[model samples]
Target chain A: MAEECYTELEQAIQVLVANFYKYVSKHSLVRNKISKSSFRKMLQKELNHMLTDTGNRKAADKLIQNLDANHDGRISFDEYWTLIDCPYMVYPATDLCK
Target chain B: MAEECYTELEQAIQVLVANFYKYVSKHSLVRNKISKSSFRKMLQKELNHMLTDTGNRKAADKLIQNLDANHDGRISFDEYWTLIDCPYMVYPATDLCK
Candidate 1:
């Protein structure tokens, strides 16, 4: 599983998981989870190109609300993956497919 | 959203999505979905580095069973994302986190 040996697909999955950790709150009582504010920032910073409404507070908030399935007010890796699975986000980003 | 403008993380997300398409069966009655056989091939080819048990038919079947949430014969993009979200698959792949 060395970096040099990782397939393009494997490397891509790693980038996603690593990005989650990058935004996780170190001081939160619940570790390895992203805060609401940080999740918003992630959408704006990391997903701006795909999600056109990332810059819109209301749209972003609605997205976070939908993603936080457990009502935890935070985004876990699974919840984040749910966002990635969103067809609306991926289908419109034609450049990503190219 | 040009490839040149994609951030590292954005590019990573694209890879995951595109990989799914790569394995999708072109002749399947159900379009844009990976068949059981194709999914196994995907695991062995694209995810061998991250999933050690991809070579084992029983283990791979069990994993596929878990991923096929709706009990559909084919693996949709959402089902594929669920596989990616599995902690067991991602956590042990230390090189992926690096």
Candidate 2:
């Protein structure tokens, strides 16, 4: 699809899905899953601004452990969606819509 | 936070969260929830490109019915996340990262 045809919301969703694939290793046994190390790197690089503990290895590891819901030791798209809960952290002070 | 400080991924996430609040009624009895009518308008305006049935009222209603997990006639943030599953529809042809 043409980039110009996408709405801002559609483009945002594409950015999210594309970011996940960008960090997914091609050599992994799973086709579209992100390995633990890559997921950590993603947190540090892509989400450092939003997540306070991205710079803390231990905290990041704990978060990864929690997100690995299927015990597959990797993050799937569904697993990654769980991080959306952190929007509270992103807008801590005010209700933007209010 | 300054707009320039956000990574592309962070900005994308903010867009998703903000879009939800934009449709949410300020006077809702339960704060932050989006009513059925507002949610439908959101689908048509924000997600028309990604969701083929946005123009079809029956289809959109069915989709909202499925998304309203609690059957409360309104959508919560968690319910909104379910729509992310449609990333498959957004990138139908090619492996975008490959």
Candidate 3:
């Protein structure tokens, strides 16, 4: 049951990524909605926000960290855009070290 | 190029569906955000809204119509929920006739 639950969460992440990616391609103007570098930065900031635990931090944080490929301490919106097209599963803790 | 374009669109649809499905399972309360029946009804109404072209009709319409599985001229919310688990490709026009 737990496995099934996790799967649902994973599916949701993929779906949102795919949806955004789809629109990004069709409407190049969507890029104007936010910059690539800015996106990554925002995502990382949101991740820290999650750690705070004052708000709906876990979900909010996971939403952002779930996107950050490298924990190199920062992400740019441009790098964030590329992930939208890829089929991404969560990175492992060890994977983050690289 | 056109084919690539279509693929992006298909991906987007799947992503959005998957994301919603994921949230629905994890946070059952998200269901309360609206009723299953109301969701379907709203979707169909949105479809009709798209046909009007007054606002951002097509995107708005496609968003809803894409969700409505049966055109019985109506969709109830419960039926809408099940598809979140299934990977749905668009129904063919002939299939719609049924």
Highest lDDT: give the candidate number: 1
Model 3, A1-98: lDDT tens digits are 13243233343434444444433333354442333344444334322221222134354335446555655323333334433333331211111112
lDDT of 3: 0.35
Q: Which pairs of residues collide in model 2?
A: none
Q: Which regions of candidate 3 are displaced past 4 Å?
A: A1-36, A50-98, B1-36, B41-64, B68-98
> For candidate 2, lDDT tens digit of each residue in B1-98?
79879899888888888898899888847798988889889988987777665767777788788889999998998888777655544463322122
Cα lDDT over the full model 1: 0.80
TM-score of each model, in listed order? 0.88, 0.88, 0.22
DockQ of each: 0.73, 0.63, 0.06
Docking class of 2: medium
Query: How does residue B4 of candidate 3 score in lDDT?
Result: 41
Candidate 1 clashing pairs? Answer: none
Question: What would the per-residue lDDT of candidate 3 be over residues B2-98, giving only the tens digit for each residue?
Answer: 3243233333434444443432333354442343444444334332221223134354344346555664423333334433322321211111111
How does the DockQ of candidate 1 come out? Answer: 0.73
Model 2's DockQ score? 0.63
Poorest stretch of ten by lDDT in candidate 3 chain B: B89-98
> Which pairs clash inside model 3?
A12-B19, A15-B15, A36-A77, A36-A78, A37-A77, A37-A78, A40-A77, B36-B77, B37-B77
